[model samples]
Target: MSTQEERSGRYLDFYRDNIERISENSSPYINSFRQNAIEEFKKLGIPTRKNESYRYTNLDTFFGHPYSSYFMPSEPDFVKAEEFRCDVTDLDAHGVVLINGFYPTITGKLRELPGGIWIGSLSEASRKFSGMIEQHYGRYVNGNSDGLVHLNTALASDGVFLWIPEGVSLGKPIQIVNLVNSDQDIFNQHRNLIIAEKNSDITLIICDHTLSPQKFLTNAVTEIHVGENAHFNIIRVQNEHNNAAKITHTFIHQERNSVATSNNITLHGGLVRNSTHHYLGGVGAECNSFGLYLSDKFQHVDNYVNVDHAFPSCKSNQLFKGVLDDMATGAFNGRIYVHPDAQGTMAYQKNSSILLTDDAKMDTKPQLEIYADDVKCSHGATVGQLDENALFYLRSRGIDKRQARLMLMFGFAHEVLQNINVEALRERMDNLVMQRLKGELSRCASCMVKCV
Candidate 1:
């Protein structure tokens, strides 16, 4: 019943012994960065079934696996562009690709971006713009995170760094391809930071591409700093192979009058956990988020979303929906906090899911902590199935039982998908969903829609 830290995990002891050795004071780029993180990781250790946030998912074997550094990647694993293929991409978009958590060679040239925007590798940013990294890195995250986040900071070796100067907007979206293809059991902590100054706009695509059979762990952290009048759209697509385990933390920091839109989509992952936290630090800022998760077979997904309205006149709207079949398990926890100073704030949150199989399980919690009396906020959660009445009506109309079920199920997901603004993304998601409705998505379901 308790979610507090347990005294029995050895990872914490590992951290107590290793934190000082891996302290950043030695130099952010110390060669031992990964080892330092490993020390902290041992201290913080992986979360157990006891941690309130991790109560639904257990990592007994995940942490028990041996750790190996991917710092010096050898020859390319020949799973080149054609084999671990990505769907077609629009050439005009700003594309940034990562292979196995490291930046990869660009086969195609990129068009010149807006004049004031600079997109480069984190190494370049750390060497030239230490000021920015110092001011913003881990600024919004809880510094006391047992050791998961600290390990991420310590072990991070590759990521994207984006900066937008004042008054400039990049209309096209920037795609970040995060690939995982290690030959052995590996743990990679990747970090990315994006800063949008006054009056600029940008969109980011975070894709998880996998092609490895080894047990892998990805603790990815992305920090976004949204300044005055800036607008940002962050889209995350998870399609990792079944053998991968990925945990992500995306932090959004907003200033006055800025807007942040975060879209989380999960189609496949062996064991995926996404933690998205937003801090509305500026007055008049607005935030909107939509998430879609589909889990089948033995896959497991856990999402934790937190929003902190620290200033007045801010607004946020969030909705997360999931579809689970077979023996898959899913969890959703959303928290919105209205601080004492955040008066006149308006916020709404909703979490919903549908389990098609009797063995499928979904647990959702929608929470609100309001310290301000002058705020309007509401939250709701639901777990149910396709409407039997709707199915019956369709069946009465001579529609086949399978077609009727597929239509109703697609209708359920449409509530969340309709909010997407990107036409291509919407179309792609539609196809994936239809694959499910048509019963061509996977083989684990018994009563599935047949796709042509």
Candidate 2:
């Protein structure tokens, strides 16, 4: 067998050897689909450059490492959890921490807020809220052909679960911090579910960080359901060391008259692939997706987005921007699909990037597939360097070359950053982006490990 095949076989063997243990730790509701998921993973195997969706990235390099999988819940480090603070300063929000993809026990299994809001562990919710879990658990991504998604479904044990009751609005946003800290190379998988009932409003923030220097690979999946007339928003920040590889899949379904927004900011990682699928299943549904990525050195970041308008009178928008320096590489593939019966659809997609060096590369594809005659859709992409005249304008104004370049890059990134509705979070991200452009630490100031 080739080296890639050997690496793939190791996971298959590991799953087979520990199937019993894996099933024993998980609830039957979650275990019911493991067999089928594993079978699908076997048929698809690890994704390679040959896969059309994965053509721009090479997964073999990240999977080739021998890493220990976390199938069972480990003991929670209460001391660490108590002392750890989020990088975003003074943000008044409910905080949830997941260490090595397992929800820490110190925070309790589940928390119920005053407004009928539920936040806690996914495993506990699976058992306690089996009816709700069964109704929406695998609905969005069950038929997906991605092997990595299936592998995560088969191996995932615990993650965050959030529920907002009907007609209620959360007083504060909920922040979920995922930390990977281990002595040895580790592979972790976590599954999250969020439900916003009818007429409810909520906001969520997700932060991914690596606290140890060992090689880490994390495969995370999140499923979100927005009820009719509900509002939901999410912001994700990814910051990890060059030794970490992070893959995330987000599936969102919107009901009639619902509104949902998703923003992703990627700062540092060895390899990062983010796949987002938005399904507008009801009339008057709206979704806005935005992303910004800054990569340098050999870091790689790929973003794939698919938006489906299945009903009439729905609106969708996508704007993704990236800045690549040194030999960094990036990719953005965005698709907007409008159903035949979906008339009066307004969809727009745009991808723009700036390459700072000759070795820095970017591949962007913005596509729109419309079957409806009365719909308006547009897609475009741009990949180039900064404007020389603009840089010279700053130079003529007595600004140094380094500061002028940083100003241009930050201006390019600010378009996406300004879309953030949370003022405090936006300001914090602004500072973080400047630090990253200045070649400072790519990690959060509060984090223990200093990985550039």
Candidate 3:
């Protein structure tokens, strides 16, 4: 057999041998889903270059290396986390920390918010909210869709779960910090769920970071449900080490008159792929999606977004931007699908990228499929280098060449950052973008390795 076949066989063997251990902590209902997911994975296998959705990305090379299958839960090292914390930590928010995909029990009382908001472990909540969890746990995610998603569903044992009852608005945001610390190569899977009832509101900040230089893989899935007339805001930041890879999927379902927004910011990683899906299930729902990625060296970043307008009078807007240097690679695919019965739909998408070096690469696809007659939809994409005239103008104004170049690059990336309405979060992103432009983020002593 070939190297690819050999790698596949090894993964199959490991899954078959660890079936029992992987489901040791799972409930019977979830275990059944896991079994079905494993079977699905066996049929689909891993994605190859031949796959249309994965044609630009090559996964076979990464599978050649062996990685640990499991990570045991342990007490988190807060002292170690201080070095990686960002500016958002100072905001007024409830903090939830996870170490290597396991929730850490820290000292303090859980913040009691107005209305009824419960934040805790999904595994612990399974006992009391089993029925509620069962009604929506596997409702949004399809089990047989992708091999990576199936693998995550098969092995995920614990993650965060949040619930907001009707008519309640959270006084502050909820910050989730996932810190990875490992001495050797490892794999981690996390499953998260967020549910908001009618007329409720919430804000969430998810931060993913690596504490060590070890090679690792993270597969995570998050399912969110927004009830009628609710509002939800979420910001995701991925700043892992250069030796790590991450594949994450986010699924959102919006009810009638609901509003939702998601901002995905990728600063550093060796290979990162993010997939976000939004379903507008009711009339007059709206969604706003934004993304920004800065890469250098041999780093690779891919982003895929799919928005489905199933009902009439729905709106969606997507904007994504990227800056690549050296030999970095980046891809953006945005798709908008309007159902035949969905009349009066409005959708817009735009993707723009800047290649700082000749060796840099970028691929973008903005697609719109509209079946309705009275809908307005448009899409566009652009990939090019900085304007030499603009760069020269800054240089002539008594600015150094390096600083001028940085200013031009930041000007290209600031449009996406401006979509963030939160003052604290937007400021944090601005500072990080400036540091990245100046080549200082990875060079700091407390931070991890450089993307290059």
Candidate 4:
């Protein structure tokens, strides 16, 4: 039998060589950070199925395109983003636009931010505060050892930087709209950072608005730091073209007595992957995570979440719901780890999926490892089809067959969606989900006899 090193493919070797070549080119903008990061990236390289965290996700096949094959469209070519507006009335929110991988200076109107809030480009922030720029740039991200993270950090010449000062609370959500305008086969990597100081409160929304005709790759990373007694909420809505690829990595670090919540909505995409890692670094920290994904056709969506209890008395709760139809595939993995010193920790996790087609694939796993004897922890997962009795009950009410099925499907998914807590955003998601479920219900109703 050949040794492990003998199986190291040429693809890995090419990646390493390219890293060295690019770093040595001496581009002032990227050369300094690139050399050190590239070396670490080579040491880490790409993760294989052997990695427990990615066992269910096949990154090799998912990221088959050459690293240099990503196309860069100059400006807004096919992305007609004017179609998406902040339509909610009486809502005052700041908006920033990113077209393809570059941010548009003249594309979106700019206004003064509320006092005590800093929102702008990372480069701009780097210039204004070099100390902060240096301390947090690569602190939360381990991109050097991860391919997608490495690629994002290496190419993050432009992205967002948001800071909320202490004791300030923004009543309205900050909307950051991402629009992709490029030819087919282009790849985009976006990195964003958010820092909330002690006792500050804020809300943020990330809307993916792109209609690209090509296979677009959006490898994005968002790092959030919640200071002591801070409160924050983040909602991400992804509605991209059918040929687009999406990967999101979000990390939240909480201080003592801090509170953080994140809700992820996968309305539509070709291949979407979402990862959330929360560190309960201080005592009394609380974290909440909820996710919903609706998959159809050849669409593929993967979600992985991990919560770490590094201190005593931390509380965490997680819930995820998935709906898969046609030949689509979806997966969910939620894990919680309690350290030995986290004796008084409290954690709960649950994941459920409703499969509307036998051809559909769904994977659900909930894991827990408690090193503390006094901790309270539990995790569970479920994957099954729609309830026949519920469908019959709805149909018996004289509702249309398609409508009846849609109600049954929505009932299973609404648990997570309703928890959104924001009426406006919740209504928008409700409408999109209505359309998706109705479409699936129509297809399922047509094959109702055969499906049984």
Candidate 5:
């Protein structure tokens, strides 16, 4: 067998051997879908460049490493959860922690706050809210053919589950911190479900971090449902070490008159791929997607976005920017699809990147597929170095070369950063971006978990 097939076979054998353990703590409703998902995974296997969606990223390199999968919940350490401090200060938000893809038994399995908000483990929520889980758990990912999605569905045990009741507006944002801390190479898969009921509003902040130097591979899937006239905002911050590979798939469905926004900031990683799918299924639905990535050394980052306009009067906008230094590489793929019956659809996409070194590389593809005649759509991409004219203008004004370059890079990245609605988060991200541009390591200074 070829090397790719050998690597893929490992996972197939793994699922066969651990199927019972994987389903041990899961509910019947969740376990019922595992068999079919694994069958689909067998047909798809691990994705390679042959797959158009995964053309820019080659998963074989990351999957070749031998890593132990986390099938059951690890020993809970509430002390670590309580002692951990978020890099973002003055941001008063509810905190939830997940260690190696399992929610720690911190404060019961589920925590229900005022205003009828539920935040806690997905496995626990599966037992308590079976009706809700059955309705939305696999709904968004039902028709997906991606191997990673199927693999996650087959093996994922627990993750974050959030529910905002109808007509309720959360006073504070929900912050979720996912940490991978282990002595040996580890493979993790976590699934998250978020429901925003009719007329409800909420903001979510997701942070991904690695606390150990061991090789870590994480595959995370999140499904979000926005009810009629509701609003949901999510900001994702990823900061891991060079020995980590992180893959995230997020599926969002918006209902009538609903508004949703997603902002992703990628700081450091060995390999990172973020795939986001947005479905505007109701009239007057709107979504805005933005991302910023900074990478140096041998790191790689990829962002993929697909927006579907299935109803009339829907709108979407995608803007992504990246800064690559040394031998780093990046990719951005943005696609907008408008159905034939969806009239009055407005969609736009743009991707821009700056390469600091001759060896740094970037690949961008912006696509638009519209079947409606009256719809408006546009797409564009740019890959180039910082404008010499701008840099020269700054240097002539008595600014040093290094500082001038940092200023120009930050200015380019600020376009995507400005869209962050949370003032505290925006400021913290701004500082982090500057630090990244100044050649500093992307470690969270205030985080209690130390890396090797």
Candidate 6:
């Protein structure tokens, strides 16, 4: 067998060997779902390059190294969860911390959630609201088609759970921090569920980081449900050490007149793959996707987005931009699908990149499929180096070549960064991206690794 197949076989064997223990640690009501997912994973195996959706990404290569499951909470390695807090602690947002895919031991100190909202560990939420969790846990995802998602469902132990009752508006954003730290090669799985009832509104910030230099993989899956007339916004930042790999899938389902927005910023990682899907289940639903990736070294970043306008009068807009230097590589695939019943659908997708070095590379694909004749849809992609004229103009005006190039590249990426509604967050990201371009950023200094 080939090396990829061998790695797949090893993962399958590991799952089979640890099935009982994994199930024992999970809630009984979800045990059957977990079993079914594992069986599905066994059938699908790990996705290979041959798979059209995974053409630009190869999970098998990332999984070639042996990685044990996350250590139990009682382990000594998990006792330092408090030291791994995100740098945004001073912000007004409420903080929810997770270490090794589970709630941190210092969770008690978190501010009490406001009325009409429930935020805590997923396991506790499952026990308290089993019916709701059961109805929506795996509703939007297809395990048979994606082995990575199936594996996450089967092995995931805990993550953040949030619920907003009808008509409630959270004035402050909620921050969810995920930290991966271990002494050996380790893999962590996180599953999160967020629900917003009718007329409710919420803003969320998600940050993922690595605390150790050891080889590690973090696979996270999140499902969000937005009720009628609700508004939901999410900002996700992935910054990890070079020895860390990250895979994340986010699914957002919207009801009538609801609006959803997702902003993904990829700052650093050895290998990172992010997939976000939005389903407009009701008329007049809207979704906006914005992303920016800054890469260098041997880093690889892939971003995939699919927006489904299953109902009429729905709309979606996607914009992704990247700046790559050295031998780094990146890919952006954004697809918009409008159904036949979507008579007034409006969809647009755009992907652009700037290569800072001759060795840097990027692949961009933006597509639109509309079954409705009256729909207005458009898609476009562009990849090029910094404009020579703009750089020369800045240099002649007094700026050095380095600063001139940095100015042009930052201008190219600022289009997407401008979409951030949170002022403080936008400022923070601006500094990080600038530092990254100047090669003055370190994983620890960038808030990916905890130094204290």
The model with the greater TM-score, 1 or 6, is: 6
Model 6: per-residue Cα lDDT over 421-442, one tens digit each: 7788888888788888888885
After superposition, the stretches of candidate 2 with alpha carbons farther than 4 Å from their true spots are: 1-4, 76-78
* Winner on TM-score (3 vs 5): 5
Per-residue lDDT of candidate 4, residues 1-452 (tens digit):
22223223333454455555433422344335655654554555555657676666665443565333332334344244434455444445666766664455544322346867888765556566566666566667643245557656655555677888888898888888787654456667667878888999998888775644556777888888889999988888877655677888888989999999989988777778888989898999999999998888888888888898999999999998889989988888888999999978999998888888899998877888889988888788888987888888888889977888788777777888887656787876776688777773222111112211
lDDT (C-alpha, whole model) for all candidates: 0.74, 0.89, 0.80, 0.72, 0.89, 0.83
Q: What is the C-alpha RMSD of each candidate to the true structure, in Å?
A: 5.1, 1.5, 2.5, 5.6, 1.5, 2.2
Q: Which sections of candidate 3 miss by over 4 Å?
A: 1-5, 76-89, 106-114, 443-452
After the best TM-score superposition of candidate 1, give how far the Cα of residue 258 lies from its true spot, in angstroms.
Answer: 0.9
Q: What is the lDDT of candidate 5?
A: 0.89
**Candidate 6 residue 288 C-alpha distance from true site, Å:** 0.4
In model 4, which regions exceed 4 Å deviation? Answer: 1-33, 66-92, 107-112, 142-145, 440-452
Ranking by TM-score: 5, 2, 6, 3, 1, 4
Q: Give the 10-residue window scoring lowest on summed lDDT in candidate 5.
A: 443-452
Query: C-alpha displacement of 247 in model 2, angstroms?
Result: 0.1
Screening candidate 1 with a backbone cut-off below 3 angstroms (N, C-alpha, C), the clashing residue pairs are: 11-42, 11-43, 12-43, 15-43, 438-449
Cα lDDT tens digits, model 2, 216-297, are: 9999999999999999999999989898999999999999999999999998889999999999989999999999999999
Candidate 2, run of 10 with poorest lDDT? 70-79
lDDT (tens digit, per residue) of candidate 5 on 1-452: 24766877888888899989878889999999999998998889888888888888877667887897655545544556656778787788998988888888856889998798999999999999999999899999879989999999998989999999999998889999998877779899999999999999999999998877888999999999999999999999999988899999999999999999999999888899999999999999999999999998889999999999999999999999999999999999898999999999999999999999999999898778889988988888899988999999999999998999999999999999999888898898898899888877556555444553
lDDT value, residue 24 of candidate 5: 85
Model 3's lDDT to the true fold?
0.80
Clash statistics: count for each candidate: 5, 0, 0, 1, 0, 0
Task: Please report how far candidate 1 places residue 7 from its true position, in Å.
Answer: 13
TM-score of each: 0.87, 0.97, 0.93, 0.86, 0.97, 0.95
